[model samples]
Target: MEDGFNIGDIVLSKMGRDSGRHYIVVSTDENYVFICDGDYHKVAKPKKKKMKHVEATGSRSEYVAGKIAEEAKTTNTELRRAIAEFEGTENVPVQQDEM
Candidate 1:
């Protein structure tokens, strides 16, 4: 965790095709981490990216972290909610365009 990143931590893709997109860290090992947005990169198949390619958001989902710590399976819905909440965009109200 010295790198300020851990499983379930929120991160931003700093490089590559997914650059600028936010994702959750699903797993990590040495210099690489597996991440997912719960949409394109589902939990079943996360993107393996180098640690340097991501920037930690200093936020984490305890529920996701706990589940992963226990080696439990997580669903896309749960992950999506966690990320939305982390980014403070959960339950966003739909805006109507003025005529």
Candidate 2:
């Protein structure tokens, strides 16, 4: 299909006994994909068509990325606060070199 998976994406199978199984995409050529479904005891191999229907598992990585972004925001804010306190002023003077 035109919407087949790309490399490095995680997916969950939606049919057969493999239903609800999670897999990681290893590679793809045309209509099939090489995948590793850890929970299903499947190692890296290209699966057959229609036997494995998968949906992308992007939410897991997205949630982790969002957490990292939040942490970065908190760290940036704290650094600004620390600089302000060290300089004994709420606003620090900007340097032309820094700009």
Q: All predictions: root-mean-square deviation over Cα?
A: 6.5, 17.7
lDDT (Cα, tens digit) per residue for candidate 1, span 1-99: 336688889999999989998999988888899998887788888999999999988888999999989988787777888888987888964232222
Clashes of 1: 0
lDDT on C-alpha atoms for all candidate structures: 0.84, 0.46
List where candidate 1 sits over 4 angstroms from the true fold. Answer: 92-99
* lDDT score for candidate 1 against the true structure: 0.84
Task: Please list all clashing residue pairs in model 2, or write none if there are none.
Answer: none
> How displaced is residue 84 in candidate 2, in Å?
42
Winner by TM-score: 1
Off by over 4 Å in 2: 1-4, 42-52, 59-99
Error of 1 at 96 (Å): 25
